[model samples]
Target: MIRVVAVLALLRLAAITVAALPVQWVALRLGSSLADRLPVWWHRRALATLGVRVTPRGTPSSERPLLITANHASWLDISVIGSLGPVSFVAKSEVATWPVFGLLAKLQRCVFVDRTRRSATGRTAGELGDRLAAGDPMVLFPEGTSSPGDGVLPFRSALLGAARAAILDSGHTRVVVQPMAVVYTRIGGMPIGRADRHRVAWYGDMDLIGHLWGVCIAGGLDVEVVWGEPQIFEATTDRKALAATLETSVRDQLRAVLRP
Candidate 1:
């Protein structure tokens, strides 16, 4: 029965993706607003098909040149966050080479960064800044990598340079850097304990195909997305300090959900 459910869920997701691909392509060519919105619609529908319920707490700021910093736990974070609004992501370059997901990420206008190369950092920051200047709210997982869904890793300060870059490119005196947290709290209608969180998390050397199949078969996932206070990021703002502050905010929010 579980295998049947997983197979059906995968089919539904594939159908949706196939249907949306051409529309997204045309929207991109025409520079239509649909290009920005269709991903959100697709993500919401995808989550529904997977029996994943998202509970968003607090509101995302409406500020322009906005950069949101969030903790990463699973590959599901993309769809989960994209479902909330028209937002792009800052992802590792390897994601751009992924089979189907890479295409989806490109359609969503994600900025891909080659993290292995130190010199690529500035270039990626500029690209992220350009997107932010174009009025796209960009989501960055400053944790640099996904965690085990039990705790947030220390956020790296390198890519926070995008905030400074946004100010320079957009002619904005300051950029709004908002902290966000994504926590998987329940699975199969029961509170998911710390030990069981690995089922939802996709970190380490976990096989993507296996993890995705497990999620589809298990279903009934409940996720909490908490948006923290928005901070004004100026040109002179210390990147290390700002990254630490945002990290603390996300860590606190995650703890509140997982512990309380």
Candidate 2:
């Protein structure tokens, strides 16, 4: 039965992924260089098990301390980007409390920001700066929350201010603010439209179990990613203006991907 197979495949996928947690934790503690990409290999297999096809475009910068900013559609964003290269995410603090995913995020060494607590912002900003200075490429979803796959939401400027701080406080003008777009292109061999996006996008109030069930049961989903031009956050660049520019670039890519 379709239900049985989907459930079995999902359970198997989770089991394998969860089983690798301790190894990742040890790697993080041991200060191994392989720590950067070990989790990505795990994610590739897990995503392959789910029958999702991810196609990426352009190239992420190889330069040290790159800061990638992108639109958030679903929890799948993590696997999609993780499949690309060696990178960690800057996520909200609450992600650490989520059941399985929170654990995985920690294994991946994701930077957590408590957006509601003003004091936490400075602390998180310091961590981000340190990571950048240490030469780890970090990805951030500037929408501050995930949205339906219809289009990109206007990016918030608060978090982006951290990019500036990284350059000024750390004296590392080497950060690349690369903009990217993740578009869910198809489901069941047909192009997906706004009407069907909710199946992939996990907006607030949507039950995670039911959403994951819907995605796993669906046939042959397709995802396309566009890596836009990388821009530098210089001393003169205003954070709000930078966010608007990147948001436009991402929205444009989404429009192109949605074209018939």
Candidate 3:
């Protein structure tokens, strides 16, 4: 199983290396259509090759200025969600420095925010607003950190301020704020207990390489993605209140997935 996982990982690396450069060049010279579509193709392949089965509920909103707020469990959340469409992400600025993952995020045109800089919030929000206004759906993990997948952490409402920025910057009366949930419900065709589920979660001080290797060898993993009803974010909307609403919806969805 380890050998199989290693070979698959290498093959994925090779595929990304071969396809990413050309796709990025085309996206830059032409437009984002190729860049957007190609990653979905790659992610789908990666999901299958990694032996992850994703079952998504409800579709992402087609409305412009869409911002998806989701719970963070592990890095696998990215691939599971990316497999859905041509969406980009709002990631921590540090991700920009990660080797291959960083490059991939850049190619996907992710909006990176420096969470430590108090003064950078406005600037980051403005950037996210610009992306939203441009019709690029952006995803944000509002918990500010990954969780253990047993439950959700309170959503940090500060970043939700970007929705207001989008409304004002774009002069759009309304923006769509979608609540999404990613739950690891099963492993090896059986319902996973809490202790077992932790194997799928990458949090605390877990080493990335070790986690990745574990995930590769852990076949028959099943993840369920639930998209809550899209809410409206207006210029007058209270960001923290809106964050609370999304938190409730995501928790409900997560509970549903984890229920026996």
Best model per TM-score:
1
Clash pairs detected, candidate 3: none
- The residue-by-residue lDDT of candidate 3 on 132-155, one tens digit each, is 888888999999999899799999
lDDT of 3 at 171: 79
lDDT of each candidate versus the true structure: 0.91, 0.86, 0.85
Ranking by lDDT: 1, 2, 3
Model 2, span 34-77: residue lDDT tens: 67778888878878878889999988877776889999989989
How accurate locally is residue 177 in candidate 2, as Cα lDDT from 0 to 100?
88
Per-model TM-score versus the true fold: 0.98, 0.96, 0.94
Predicted structure with the largest lDDT when compared to the true one: 1
* Residue 146, candidate 3: alpha-carbon lDDT: 95
Give the clashing residue pairs of candidate 1, or none: none
Error of 2 at 144 (Å): 0.6
Clashes of each: 0, 0, 0
Candidate 2, 192: how far from true, in Å?
0.7
- RMSD value for candidate 1: 1.0
